[model samples]
Target chain A: MDMRVRLTLAYDGTGYNGWQIQKDGLTIQGELEKALSRICSASIRVHGSGRTDAGVHALGQVAHFDPPPKFLNVPWNRALNAVLPPGIRVLDFARTDRKFHARFSARAKQYSYTLWTQGAFFYPQRRNFVWNTGPLDLEAMQEATTCLTGSHDFNCFMNKGTEITDTIRTVRNILLAPGFTPQETVVWIQADGFLKQMARNIVSALVQVGRKKLSQAELKSIIQGRDRALAPATAPARGLCLEHVTY
Target chain B: MDMRVRLTLAYDGTGYNGWQIQKDGLTIQGELEKALSRICSASIRVHGSGRTDAGVHALGQVAHFDPPPKFLNVPWNRALNAVLPPGIRVLDFARTDRKFHARFSARAKQYSYTLWTQGAFFYPQRRNFVWNTGPLDLEAMQEATTCLTGSHDFNCFMNKGTEITDTIRTVRNILLAPGFTPQETVVWIQADGFLKQMARNIVSALVQVGRKKLSQAELKSIIQGRDRALAPATAPARGLCLEHVTY
Candidate 1:
């Protein structure tokens, strides 16, 4: 019997090259496989709920793997974290039925983009975690997020090389929290799923509107136009974090 | 005529050993001296409010130096930050009175330590910051702080190598904020002066009492006893931040 293990993981993406296997560099998936293999004493394959680009963080990323027979006594949560690096931590673990899959079963994903406006540089210690946009207009950005909320063809908000046949994505919720703090603005978006660079692209457009480079009507037109060329540049991946996953 | 130069600095404290100028590897003072030497075309000495041991951090550390002829109009703040490596930043610049001294003339200082009990090894980025101590009694810790206020002999809290002429310091305040949403605790301390590892050591002792290791009577005895052996070990330096300074 194939035993499916579901793991909720959080990681500082600054050190790894995202949540996928890469032949050339360090990656979250690579590190997990390495730890799982050592603990179970057999080859293992781990799958993630979604792919986060390089420098993007994750607070509640979900993954599942089939445990090898030799490692029957290995506790999925404790054993894995003990061997993993400092930036990666396992929050919770569960034994799942064979029908469950992390990537396939995730019904919705939530991501948050932090914008620190007061200062261009971050707290030296937290510099790697937040995006420093340097004092943006909250009302303008909030108004723009409303236009980005409903279902739409998100081709305009995706990276150019994305290979998905359909670039359509339904943004289930986009709660633009304005003036939450004196020094920071935050945008939280939850969607059925996100295309490559979708959240970042949306953020860039919001930033533009906040800076007065674009109008709300113009932003709505960009979404309606459904042209990749219509959106602003992709915001840096460092600012985005996968906040949670809903099954 | 003597000129006063105010410096707003940032340092990683990971390399070159602490903030003071030592014969060892690299010190923040040594780096600033080098930058000043190049900019001023003459050697200049820098004085910090206080010395931070190796592996400490500062967001708004205040320092003062006398300007040499060549450094004039060099845009010292921007130039120095650009020249400094990724770990240090010079955020602001000011020219002050000739009587100013960073160490002796300083009136007060504020420090904060952050602890999170989440037990997740995966810190979002910049995990090097905020020491992670699993769940502890913050209310107990806050209560313990009241025992430490006012003028007291802090010799018990000083580290082994400290060489201060006096052991008595006035603690203006010690604020204990209960854990925030992420199960994090922040300890903020303000004082007229501090001994070596004083804040860290005080935090250590308080934490022990907070976790039920020592009683409040024991805490009073340790302070009155003025013996270094009576207190808990110094807390990790990584979690402590020199938050503010007053001249």
Candidate 2:
């Protein structure tokens, strides 16, 4: 009998096209499948919990796969890493029940966005990991998050091209706190599910509030209006990371 | 009258060849000179405090150049960043007297090396910034540093190809401490002058001591041996960073 195995993946998405297997480009899934197949000596498929856009990193993205029974007892953590590239790794692996699906069994996901809010030029070591935004009004950004928390019809935050009609998502909170440096701020958002570009779009609105270009009251009205046209542009992809996914 | 201008640089050396200008490679100095020459409408020469090997990063590497009188008032902090690639950044700048040389007038320098000493894989985001060594004896590594502190004849620690006969220099200390994660250790080494691959050579020996292959007393013997062949191989350059330079 074969058992389902789950793997927690961490990757610097800057080098890949995205998380999905695409015909024309390199991706996190494609790399995983290639490495796994080589180790198993057979065809292998990988199912990620979800897709991350290009340049979006992941600290703990989950995936599940059914491996050949002969390979079940392999020391996966070290075995996978030995064959994988430097930009990707298997952080942890464990046996799971057949009912456990990488996507449908997920309960919530959390993402963190980094903003270098102090100066025109931040440290070069973190250039790929942050959005440089000079200086921002921290208080206004915090106030904007309060309104975005909890369950809401976030149609306004979804990308205009996305076809999802039911756009409600239960955003637990948007925690804004200082990062490694005082001038840097990391915004963490936890939600049951995110619509296409929903988290980035929400962050765009909060940054607008921080800039004083949009008021907190205006943000509330935009959600009630449910018009994507009224929302600000989607934030850049490099600043975002899939921090964790809870089942 | 033309005055000397000092510039503090920060760069992710993963992309550039090194700190010096070379005819065959894309180097950090070559890029800086190109950008400055374009801005000044004349060829500009930059003098770094020292050269860093390929793949070594810098948080506060210092450099100096004499600017034309007409361009003296240029807001160099923002101007340099506007033209340089994302990998290189000018953190600070100021006008200085000709007596303050970026190379000759330096007092001391600090470098840091990161090691992920827990598992086969570390966070992919930090893959380029750390040396992944599966579990090391922390106490042994700390003990080895005791014999290496202060001014001494470090001929054994210098690289073989280096021709410097006077190898005596004051090594302030090498501090090994816990990093962001419990399993990660960061080593900070401060010195008045670093010989070619001296910092890396010291770390290689320390790591060997941590593994129990080289005891603390054996390290002392190696120093006494004063033979470059007796020293361990130099550590990888990616894990090293020129943290600071004080004048």
Candidate 3:
């Protein structure tokens, strides 16, 4: 009666060290494993779809784990949520076949970055959830995203020191939309895969273009050059969120 | 020359004691005074419309202070916001007549209390801003509000140990509406003035009616009884917010 369970998680990453298990800091993976182990009364391992940097939130981060038959009768989602801290929640859970894998079964992912354009004051409630950058040229940023669509070698947007040799990523779309507030904007990017710091770096480059510090043609050149140093510095991790994953 | 300035303030009260200045704990008033004093190079005292309880938020809390003429050249709102912590913000500021008083000139005030009915989990970002109660009978609550409207002595709903003797107050309206989330509900109450904890106690009584623990006629009797001991416990301060103050 052993079953593999797939769980969709949502978490506020303000206090987490990221999705991976680290020895010195708190992490999403560490908390999930501990909660699952406590609930099942046995050691449990969870495999996440991917690693998110420190301070990056997630609304639909998927994971998978195997549970013994005795625990299967319990309402797993509610049981897990009761033990988890308020910052992390299990949004959905279901039994899956043994062949299903959280990381390998995912086909695409989407990330959204929020920017507060108002300079007069910062919203206290959203202090840890958004990037407060005073005013940007919206038209310029929108035009810059046009060039970012489609498949490209995103090595320039990737963080240095990463071991992945394949720098290519297929960007399905790049969208800029109004956020919940009038002074906020959301940048949503969908891609087959992302390199380390790729989403944040891409946002930084778009911001530079909006600020008129880098021309559209220069952005194109930077991507073509495939040099990380040539692009603008990576945007802060707080503004980035893993919004969805398409399987 | 001294110029009286009116400031509309907003703050997330998660980290502070309350709006009043307290010796042993951090408070919104203390922080505002410190920021204003630093900006003006002198000790500045601010007069708030009223004091909000510990953990109560505000969207349009009004205050006033006199500033030296030299400081008028500075953008007061922007300057104060720069120095204030992220939890507090100055939403608006303007020079007012010497006769205008933040506390005395206010005609009425509006307060809103948010109740999160979703029992599945708590929202981390809103942990300090909402009351997490499971589902309630919205229609029953609405019916119960009918007994709470109009001018009356709200002694039964008032928190004990207050020095104010007169408890008669005019309630302009009591509104119950759906909150931003489908699982949440908002209670908006407007009045000439509210005694300490009156709004919260009222809501608590209404919730009792919603749960069928109390009847509408019994709620009317509680108001007529005018005895604080006869009423239900006051609702948590985290759910209450000073939404607006009318001049």
Estimated TM-score for each candidate: 0.94, 0.94, 0.88
The per-residue C-alpha lDDT of model 2 at residue B97 equals 85
Once fitted onto the true fold, the runs of candidate 2 whose alpha carbons sit more than 4 angstroms away are B178-183
How high a TM-score does candidate 2 get? 0.94
- Chain B TM-score against the true chain B, candidate 3: 0.97
Model 1, B59: alpha-carbon shift in Å?
1.9
TM-score, A chain, model 1: 0.94
Q: What is the lDDT of residue A45 in candidate 2?
A: 86
Residue B86 lDDT, candidate 1, scale 0-100: 62
How accurate locally is residue A232 in candidate 2, as Cα lDDT from 0 to 100?
Answer: 92
Model 2 chain B: lowest-lDDT 10 consecutive positions = B177-186
Candidate 2: tens digits of C-alpha lDDT, residues A10-62: 99998789899998888999999998898998888889888899899998999
Please write out the lDDT profile of model 1 over residues A4-104, one tens digit for every residue: 88999888898688889988888999999999888877789999998888898888999999897555556788888889997888888998777999999
